[model samples]
Target chain A: MASKKNLVPRRDFIKTSALGLSALSIGLPLNSALATSCGSSGKDKLGIALVGLGNYSKGQLAPSLLETEHCYLSAIVTGTKEKEKEWAKKYNIPKGNIYNYENFDDIASNKDIDIVYIVLPNSMHAEFTIRAAKAGKHVICEKPMAVSVAECKAMIKACDDNNVKLSIGYRLQFDPYHKRIINLSKENTLGSINYVNADFAFTIGDPTQWRLKKDLAGGGALMDVGVYCIQACRYSFGQEPIALRAQAFNSGNEKFKEVNETITWQMEFPDGKISNSTTSYAMSVNSLFVSAQKGKAQLMPSYGYGGIKGFIKDEILEFPKFNQQQAQMDAFALNVKNNTDSIVPGEEGLKDMKVIEAIFKSLEQNGARILI
Target chain B: MASKKNLVPRRDFIKTSALGLSALSIGLPLNSALATSCGSSGKDKLGIALVGLGNYSKGQLAPSLLETEHCYLSAIVTGTKEKEKEWAKKYNIPKGNIYNYENFDDIASNKDIDIVYIVLPNSMHAEFTIRAAKAGKHVICEKPMAVSVAECKAMIKACDDNNVKLSIGYRLQFDPYHKRIINLSKENTLGSINYVNADFAFTIGDPTQWRLKKDLAGGGALMDVGVYCIQACRYSFGQEPIALRAQAFNSGNEKFKEVNETITWQMEFPDGKISNSTTSYAMSVNSLFVSAQKGKAQLMPSYGYGGIKGFIKDEILEFPKFNQQQAQMDAFALNVKNNTDSIVPGEEGLKDMKVIEAIFKSLEQNGARILI
Candidate 1:
């Protein structure tokens, strides 16, 4: 009975996720599940038009569409003519569907593109998301939704004004391991978790990368990988922090002249629990630890593109792996087909940015505990 | 070749420590290897007197003494009459060797008792250590050597005045896994380590226990378990922190009214690396992570009395295991037999307390970054 209580979620998830991983068609894709309820929607799979041909769009999103049952890569919007040509031939995207940035507004009239997945840089997220919404397409923007909390709010408002759905690409929210962890917490498995330790770090290379530039990146490690740690604690506790204090450190490396090399923070929850976390661009560390009144759950090398392993109490959790990008895209595609918003909507991104903004503020104010 | 460079310390340590673990004599104990120069000093095994029969002493120290070759439990001191009577009978201790706190000084004449291990509460560490030294007995005091750095310094001075050795009971210092980590750092096996994350925590019960009292326990998690986290970061970095900042949180439970429930801190090392760590009494967790330019090394559930597991980059590390308490005691006994001091002297305990004090000070000053 005790084992049953602890092991049920992972077992059930792995059994189903193993099938979903191979293809998003457990029963003829997710969109068809809601297709009969749609009075006028008769599309086979929602057509997704990627708004940026960057590494994320070209590598993860485009490839993920091959396995996604609810969505197919249909069109692409890019500034580089060479990339537009390259992506069109590779994904078999029709010439009529390949739109440049200057002609992105014309996507409103293109019936071939049902959703615009905004996979642009940090500073460009709000503009592209707002523009995509105004172009009569549902929007799924990459993380940080925008550089600032205000931008995130504006993006949310723009999507609402245009009667379109918006989702920040927080793929980890759909991960089996992450879902299992949240289920454990919800089931009171660890007993009102009061302590959370989350960290994500990797050595940054190339000083000339746009991610190191404050204008394009908005912030350093926080805007990039640090957001994952923040999300982990927030999701683990299921409670927003009421107050936080933070410290920032930078390597003497010339590469970090415009940004922090590392940042550590403590978030105080309303119930007196606290989360201690760090995100670094000067080192390599990825893990999450949560402690409650009963027992602890932890994982090292957690929150990766793949190979996230951890344990709940004494049970080693080997959750089935899947294409994270495919899962995320399928989720958004289902929302687009059903005319509903994803669970991880723009508000989720806004909350994370609010905490992040306060963290940077705390660092600027010499490590003061700032109310969020 | 790379494997050889990283795995040599474990190989050499296991080759020698395997012998030390089973019997303190490889032919003779480590002290005997140094003892021939001493005139008329020929002891087969050193006698150790345990002061204060608390949980740690009763549970760990007593059982571990049975496994140790260089040291045996020869006497016990306790203010509690029933405990003294019970322990003396169980350990077959002679009546003359047993004493209460009031009569502890008379042990000076008992040549059978060579080392006095102070396992008392934090407040009593200084008095017992200084008295034991004056009684011509070498001292091994438990961590958080005293309530204040001043007491730690005084304890050291007393030991130096009496020409007796003093060692802080940091059992993990002898742990094979920890030794591997330190060796990796000192050897630059992981490149110049730039980031370290170490946390130790456990939920404290019993509102009336001495650990809950500010006077008896000194401080909360920071002085107790948190010191281990501090030690881990310091040893992993192989550098002392130049500056540190901290935050303290409390469980709403009335038991923690006098002390913190959790404390998180960031220490800035001289080479621009940072160690972020936390200690908690409101929950349970233990882990250590260190990252450098080359790779990283880490252990979760790292500081337990047993089952300390970790990895060195891509390889899972499995070092030879020994009884932690026995290793610590035998090493101290060897120091006694050889007329030498253990490596973790009173000054080491003092250094930890100084950092701990600064952490608390930083918390008091609203998370100010203090120069260490």
Candidate 2:
């Protein structure tokens, strides 16, 4: 449902500048997204209004907006009155710019807020993104775009119909270490990646949370943290998988009775490149390892808020750590101001959702192989 | 075909000793196998003849034999006459004690050779083991005991019929770091293990070698280095997997036409514990990661000749490196001299073959679930 023209230009972004190529070897600060030019159409920064004011918005996006050059936090939409007052006092927003979820659609009339950043729960992403798109505002929805492929398609259709750009909040795509990984993968520097072993997991507390509720979460660990592993493999290989087989496991824990505690899946690509990934809510693990014909490249603690380290063969990947969320927002703002294509468009998230749907289907069939 | 009574006593060995239990915490030198007693029946050290002068015999087993406290390199069997004379002079073995592969059965009259260690190719293991047993000598066969389950059964029956102890050359059982892992698993130090992710791969050279031939090596990477991953998972969990799903990948490389270039498999245990493992001939990767209820335990570059490191939670496992092959030979020698049950008996290798057979069956069925 996404605009084909918008998705087609993504390959150009992958061909990053010489600065990014040098950053891969020198371990310097990578700001290739800032250097990207689609023939700039605007001179002023864009204003962003964050929806849902959740932990991610409060802990990461709000703080990152303070440092982002192309975007600034101008407004907020929240249901809680305390957060509205606390964030208003903390960020110094004007009274006219404040709105609650009930009056969020009125944001269409406000010209100051150019973008709506959805930082909501798993199942709430599609509703907020579609609403923001219908309101004629560009949207930046967090990862897993939505819980299902149908929701993803609907969100993309709304944005396409409204003629507003939509980007997924895949912060690692703007990271320096991950930029190096992407370059290495695209360049075949390690000789055609043969296998990928990725894992992202952590112990989730609060069994009463929405993430444990199947209706609110749509799925379990695979829908939550497993999306990151899927993203890592796709970006590392620069291709989509052709087939998948997945298994969901339960360890007799009462807390995960309604959701999966652990899930592992294998993906087979067209060129015989295979990937194995696991996402769990019962353990702590964060790593992305790629094996190629010539050598190996890996990142431990790869997908996180900060402190992502990488190693290719004998050399350690050195890059200055920056706020990934800031980079992501800046890139999205540039695309909005210039009217250029998004690096991580709605189609990207939809592709991942398709894989997730296939994984769930495989699990339902007791780990039968499902063609994607 | 293996003596069931001999395999039954292995549970006693798993209980280890107070010294070994303390060694797990203190990271001290582990000599538990040497401390095991069944009653001394002989007083002298055993004499060992290493069959085949390949890389393992030349690089590891022969050198370890010189340092073994309960075994000495009394002779050797080699098809090449040049290696026979070279080993005879280097180890001070008399000419009469040496024999070629064709006349290996003549060792029945030689009192100097008490044990024959089979270090030949994959397909030759059963043949040499059975011949050594017939010659009234104890046998120690290298891993992947034989090409098929039937071969393993026949070899075990031959040893049982001959009434000579038959052990498998599984050296990690004598390692201090692995001993600590075993203790952690059995004691449930990290709570019941929920998942294991293990990989052992290295870029293999020489396309013309027998390892690339199906009839010679039985399988490619799975039979070569992948056996170690299977061993690591089973030992880490102290249980056999009840079912498995396996996938074999080929990257259109002509060198691997007769065998698999890469293979990945997932195993499900009775308690709902799961494991994911990979073995490849086109990449460099060595790791074993375990996720349990309370914490994680791992080892990078876990399986090799030496320099195995381990980590559990916040602690770094530290232990002095001793020759693993020496410990394995010495332990077997002690079992022979004291007339005790071998810890790593032929049955241990047979059990692994059952898993491998299941893996191949699953692969033949295109990764369908195969119950073991």
Candidate 3:
């Protein structure tokens, strides 16, 4: 049975989203699914099943799940038995709520788990998200939605056919500083931004890590931290780039034999607004700078999970610090409970993948201008 | 009456520089041109004749001449009679030592002046430097050397033919901060340099100014402040770029109708050490950042007349401030007295002009990579 048993909202969503009738559309007596209070009780808060127990899930997501008002960590799916047992015990999860990857599809019978959060590697995101969608649960897949545009489309289709919601894990969209950046664009405060510069680079360790391999990582730094630069420029300008030129370089390091070590690209938007970005696994630099007609704005150390500070011209932009993961989870949970569309849906991730594909094509042709 | 009447050093210089014999080879009996004393007295210091009294000469160079140990102001040249009279009265210049543009060539008879400093517009650089060479004086042509590579070569040839010393007015070459940057490259403190970023831009004013015209300025910010970004990258890497790609944009501002408002370019050196730069008449940004194998170095507010601060991997680079123009003029004066070649000769300016020509070519081809 689908966790969202009520079918009235699903039918209305289908009509509005223009997804034609599918085999999964079945009628059920509609009841109020919205919660009256946002509390820790199992019935009041949405239950989230984390599909991977990676470092991000262990260090950031699990701790943030404890603090989220609209969501609670109720189950986990891990290949390792030890981690499954460890997480179940730590979070007071029932033995029935824990399952290894082999038995993950049986989650269709678990009515308590309403959402599945896919925190796997770049290539594994599509498989787990599609499996979770087939099991009738809302899916929140981590960034770079999949290895290619085809996989991203398949993931979106599976969620739509299963009558479940799909969202890309874009935590910064909930960040107050990022919201202010969007406001600056909407308000036309800086007056027609002419140039933007964004960079996120760090020296990677462990030559054998999955991120150093193209198969698991898809691309190198461009697929990893480079997406953050792309997101920042888009949010800052509130527009998409039309064409781009990109260059890639490697330092002859054995660690980067299968992937790029550094990549830089210049993008042009409508009306000749331009942006330049650099992402590398060989250096450490993080900044998002914008030059406008009348003033400027900058954020150094911009893409970190926390401690993101910035300035709009002469004014310092300091907001109350909160866990971005928690904010992202709570927002997703509210959308699930209300049967509302997500702001960062699967299409958002697909757009970035398109830009990444164009960047690679430009690199292959010796830094040619590639149209998106 | 070439200023350096002694002929032995000139003949030696010709042999070392590999310049074929020319007509102007007459010489006087050898006498000690080197000064025994360093003081304000007439014979002890090389006398500098200011060729143009623009804002730079009026505000910085003139004051610096007062503090220079080896050079002092003794003559003035201007098209405006009012400025000529004003400068003569302010600096105690005699009527015979002062001349307008029409009478400037007559300075050959005035043995009081040993150096002619060309501080004119971009297009006027070649004319004044060549005339000063014919008038038998060492020439210090301001940065950019001239509007084109051909002009720079002609200036060098004229100075060579007259057997007078020729130096480009690159004041920053005398700065301690710049010296440290060069040392970092030589020492390889940051290991093999991988990436570099430099930018110098400002929102320009006065639409009718010479800087906004194609004829007077040659280009916009590239010819003015963008050269600094190029210089910083060259000094930091100590290697010339082998290839480059460039893009130019204009904001449809009427003032920039004849020139570019902004330009960005990327360059690659022998080992694929890449650099990105931006220059503009539409924004304000100044920085020089380098990312290497071991560490990083940055200088925000990097290129200016004064107050340039920087850091090398967490260590703040603060040194005692001194007048760079004074240091530059004093060093050139010492080169003339000792018959030594200037470190910043016309060849350095010619090299920069060559790179600039390639950048313009790339810009014309829609940011195509051009071999330098």
DockQ of 3: 0.37
CAPRI docking class of candidate 1: medium
Q: DockQ: which candidate is best?
A: 1
* Model 2 pairs in collision: none
Task: Sort by lDDT, best first.
Answer: 2, 1, 3
Which 10 consecutive positions of candidate 1 chain A have the poorest summed lDDT?
A31-40
Model 3 lDDT tens row, B235-307: 8888998888887876588888998988888888876577888888877887788878787787766887788
Instruction: Give lDDT tens digits, candidate 2, residues A305-358.
Output: 888877887779878768999999999898877677888999989999999999
Residues A73-139 of candidate 1 have per-residue lDDT tens digits of: 9999988989977888899999999998788987765657778898888999988899887775778
Cα deviation of A246, candidate 2, in Å: 2.4
Candidate 3, residue A107: how far the Cα is off, in Å: 2.5
lDDT of 3 by residue, A158-243 (tens): 98777677889889898887777777789999898777889889989999988888899899999989998888888888899888
Q: Which run of 10 residues does model 3 chain A get worst, by summed lDDT?
A: A31-40
Computed on C-alphas against the true complex, the DockQ of each candidate is 0.53, 0.34, 0.37
Q: What share of the true interface contacts does each candidate keep?
A: 0.91, 0.49, 0.30
Q: What lDDT would each prediction earn against the true structure?
A: 0.82, 0.82, 0.81
lDDT winner: 2
Cα-based TM-score, every candidate? 0.88, 0.85, 0.85
Residues B1-372, candidate 1, lDDT per residue (tens digit)? Answer: 112222224433443344344335334454432232121148787788999898899999999998898989989998898987789889999998898999999776565678899999999999999999877678999998998988988998987666567899999989988888888877888788878989998878888888888999899988899999888988888878888999888757788988888888999997678999888887787888888878878887799888988898888988766788999998987866655557688878888988988998898899898988
